[model samples]
Target: MAKIPKVPKTVLPKPPRQAVPPPPPYVPLRARPVRPQRTNLPNQQSPPHPSAQETPIAPPGTTRSDRLKQVWDERPRVSDIKRLTPEQLSAPTHQNRMNKWRQWTLFICGMSAFGMGLYGMQIYVSLTTAPDENAVPDDLSDRFDKEADGYDEKVSMAETMLFLNSRRKALMQKVRGHVLEVAVGTGRNTPYYPTKQCATVTLLDSSAPMLEVAKRKWKETHMEYFSRVFFKHQSAVDPITPPYGAQDGYDTVVQTMGLCSTNEPVKLLHSLEAATKEEDGQILLLEHGKSHYEWLNSFLDRTAPNHALTHGCWWNKDIGKIVEESGLEVVDMKRYNFGTTWWVELKPRKGMRKQLEDAAKEEVEVAVQKSWSWWSFWR
Candidate 1:
């Protein structure tokens, strides 16, 4: 047992020493405490910020003066805008004076030419057209018969020049329900009638030829409404009988330029009044008469004789006065073209229609009595 213990003690080797990490490299302690270096984790670096001293980079090839000018132009200003007055805009100048002078000269020349042409036209018509001493109220039928063929063509230019078609349209647009158009020459107002509004339209004219022309026009323009229209070859001065369906009275009585042709305009208006519904019936008249101006009236008066001889129209008559004398209530009245053209809307007075009817009835009774007496005497 002694030999075994000595042998184990001699065989054991010395143990190896363990390694120690070096102390962190010497970092000198700062006099003032300094911020410790930030320890960044993997892939977590921050971007650098711009400094206040940075300047804007100019565009290539642009001058400093050019850049300054661009900045100046883009800057906003409140006082740059201005508005000019009419006086400043229309300041007198040589060119402006010349233009005004030329305009005035042309206007005067044009007016003079118009006057001369009007005088010449009157002369030409008076000389060319045959005048009949009998072409008064009773013989107007004959005169119109002769004039019917070329009448529309003869008057179209004057009507257009005066814009008379528009005036007729304005007047006829007011017509509604059962309508009676007296002195419907060639049916110039035919196309303007609202066919859907009028239940019946009676066209009355003195001349058979004129009625025929009106019939043809109505057929051509409003053939679908044929059943609604009727033509009467009779004078307006005579009592107007309502068409077959409208036996009571016409809703509207229209006469354009007729007062100028009739010998007794007031009588014509009275007849119209008699033919309309007493309560709500309207009488529409578009006529040419003495102008408001005395100078124009004098001109019309001077030319009236020849004009009447040629056209059988006494255009110098005072239509307003005639309407007033007819005793109809004036609803609306307007004048155009220096008061020579008139548009009148009138309503029948309450008892005026009855008075006219009684007078007419008495006259008819007297005529029948006279005829009976004459027949008895012959027997």
Candidate 2:
């Protein structure tokens, strides 16, 4: 190892002290000199000149004592700041207040929309289920059509009830010949039936309570007509074969607000057709059905099940197609009461009577053929 060289002593430079200059000599300002006033000589008074009576004037910069008195001209004393600069009160501040208002408005609107949405959801959920349908009896025929007094009076007081009853009366008057009224609740239409046009009337329903009411009403209003009116307690789809009697069959069948609650409307119409004279019989209807409007139909579909559960009625049905497919020709059809219901009158097609006869003959022939084949096989 080489011997280390001797280290030199390092000295740090010291900062110099700056001298602070002494403050300038203090001197008091001299007072302004006052001018001497001239005095009048004793006993030698100069004759009073016009200029002598004049008030003494103040020097250039001096103001008169009375004039110097703060000009307190009752300046409109403003309790607040009076002279604000334009920049201090600009439109930007006003805009900030408006923005705050807009925010508050938006918050209120959002809350209102949310509440409405929840209410609508609740209504929709209640209307589209089958629990209500299961509660009704399979047959509601006799009780609904029972003749009763005061049934109309009891129902007509409500606006909705009165409207339904009035329309029912109007529709029943159109029936003729051997007439049948289906689901004739409380026999309200019994008083309105045209006895002249209809030689006999058949009232059909399934509810026993309703039929009892109808019976009382029919006996009270038109007992003579009741003699011609027959009451039947049966399901709409029950068979009406030979034992039911062809002479007793109806030529004109009417239904109002009935199809909505039927278990199988298409089958019900077919059964009605089978119970009548195919060539001469007709079906008249005034009923609310599934709407053609997409939105309305959707709403009805969703809510109908709920209505059935709560009101013992269905709100959705396709009455037109059920009638048409029952081998009837639609003669007249119209939407009534703002498209809420349809009124239709239909008759069997000209060819339908012949077709039925042919079908019956074919059925017999097929039975004969099958019997012959069985006999041959045994032989």
Candidate 3:
């Protein structure tokens, strides 16, 4: 084994030490020079820096949360309220227009309130006061006679309001073949009847004066079709014979505003059915009655007694119920004015009833035959 030679040890010289400077002389905080703080004049404010505008600088000692509260508290108080002068008030600017609108609104509100008050008072009086024995006539026909002379004039306003002439036109346009118009008051529907479509038009009413007015109206408007028009003075509930032209039966029987005045509306409807042909005859009716809504129905019921005395109509009658009880089949039915006004087309159900009975009889016969066959097999 060879012995390893030892490496010679090398020594490096050390660098000289540098001098250390003495610490700064101590000075008391109170002895230090004070910097002058910049302040804005009372009337003049300094322009905000661009950075400060985005992020506001808080006071030296204030915390972030306290800075927000302090900023809110130091905010300047200013009012934007303004008063208008007479010139500005009367000017035709937006504000002036707004004022006018407000005035009109107030006027309308006041007028509506006044009207409502009057209506409420009327309802109260009608409900509270005992009706006089002589207030209404026992024979309502007499009331019609008395009103016949001015009947057209009296109802013109309401007719216009309700657009009844348009309704009459619509109904009369549907009239075909021989026509019978019951409760013809002042012939309001006469002008609307199609001369060519109707083979004959018979006007029937209980009130003689009303009949006279109807005749006059027919003579005035439909004199050209005088041969086709006839006037009959009788109650609608009375048994009516078919006119000379319509020997089988009236093809169309029309009654407008009639059921309201009648004591026996169901009887009237039945009588109308009897007068009409059983196969193809139609009964057309336009009437005002109890509304679908209970509130309106209540108003009608509350006002009915007094209204009947003056108008000779029980306005609260359930026209639908009356028609249902009459046993006539409704062909078409429509309502307007919140279901208070009804336009109905009805036909006799005799043919339908016979058909149903025949069908039932055939079914019974088939069942009986089946049972007899089963018994025979068992035997």
Candidate 4:
């Protein structure tokens, strides 16, 4: 509604045009289509395609050779590539005669070593076999006493087969504080005992002759370790009570390859449990029995008679089953060498003594409450 004013317009200059690039020259399936010469045959007149005359111009910064390679790669099948022959494809990269000979030589050496080991084991097992059943420790003791000097050597011969020394070493290394080695035959386990960490050791045995050899073994190597070492004349089934006082029960009880021949193995186990401190005392055992494999078990069964008779070892004893029946809490149990060999650690059950007493009392009560009856026939 008020006065309207006219505004002046300013114009800007347009930019100048430069030369435009031409479209890239036509490219064919092949880099070069054959061109016809002036004197060529009648139908091939002066190259049929006008593109032949077109002369390709490569993009800036690229040579004609690079353009040629791009077209070449686009082709589905490359005519210039060489194919492999069947003979070359089948040839192994590492099939020299020297390699073949080396492989065969290694195989032969391995088999020879295996055969030699087997031969040595057969001789060793035969030598360690006891001459009679271990019905009496005195009988076994008498035999062992005569062989005491040669005993260590005989066992050494079977180390690889039976793993006797290794098992003893492992069992003894674990024992500490006041310790007990029951059925401490020849003191074979003393060599590995952790006596430096322990206060005292009590070596107990029923067989006097075996004790004598064990005593000699102690005097030889372990003489300086113990503050006090007692040699007790006792059986495996006997309780660790009386004269020694606090040293009677132990922190660890070690038994290796010894329980397999006892007259009453489970009874011995019960007695061993009672002899240890009920709160924390442990038992370490490495024992063998019938192998799980049918063939091996059968062989053991066949050999068990003469084996027990001569070696005083019952080869077919099921050590695992016996330990379970012994009422000790097996904290850890491992089997090796075809389920025949067992490495077990057991602790005293919380109320073992009470359980045995209760069982006995129940048995007596049942016997007294019994009502006699000649039984009526199927009425």
Q: Highest TM-score, which number?
A: 1
Cα miss at 271, model 1 (Å)? Answer: 1.1
Write candidate 2's Cα lDDT for 1-379 as tens digits: 9999999999999999899999977643332223333457775644433223334444577666645443233122343224645563344543354456567779988876775686567665675343554555654332333424444553354324226666767787777787777777777677777787977777777776676777777888877777777777766666543223346456888877777767688766666665566667878887787776778777776677666544445666767667766766788888755465888887755555445545556767898877785568677
Q: Ranking by TM-score, best first?
A: 1, 3, 4, 2
Q: How accurate locally, in lDDT, is each candidate?
A: 0.79, 0.64, 0.79, 0.70
TM-score of every model versus the real structure: 0.65, 0.52, 0.60, 0.58
Off by over 4 Å in 3: 1-138, 351-379
| Candidate 1 stretches greater than 4 Å from native | 1-139, 372-379
Error (Å) of candidate 2 at residue 338 is 3.2
- How far is 216's C-alpha from truth in model 4 (Å)? 1.3
Per-residue lDDT of model 3, residues 259-306, tens digit only: 999888887887787778777889999999989899999878777877
CA RMSD (A), model 2:
35.3
lDDT of 1 by residue, 1-379 (tens): 5655454456678789889988977753432233333447676643222222133466799998999887567443334223535553454432354466568779988986896698578766654563553543434446678888788988886787788999988787899999999999889999899888899999998889888999999999999999888889877877778877777689999999898787777888888888999878898989999898998897676667667765768878898888878878999999999999998999988877778878878888998877785558677
Q: How much is the lDDT of residue 188 in candidate 3?
A: 91
For candidate 3, the per-residue lDDT at 307 reads: 72
RMSD to truth, every model: 26.0, 35.3, 29.7, 26.6
Lowest lDDT 10-residue stretch of candidate 1 = 46-55
TM-score, cand. 1 vs. native? 0.65
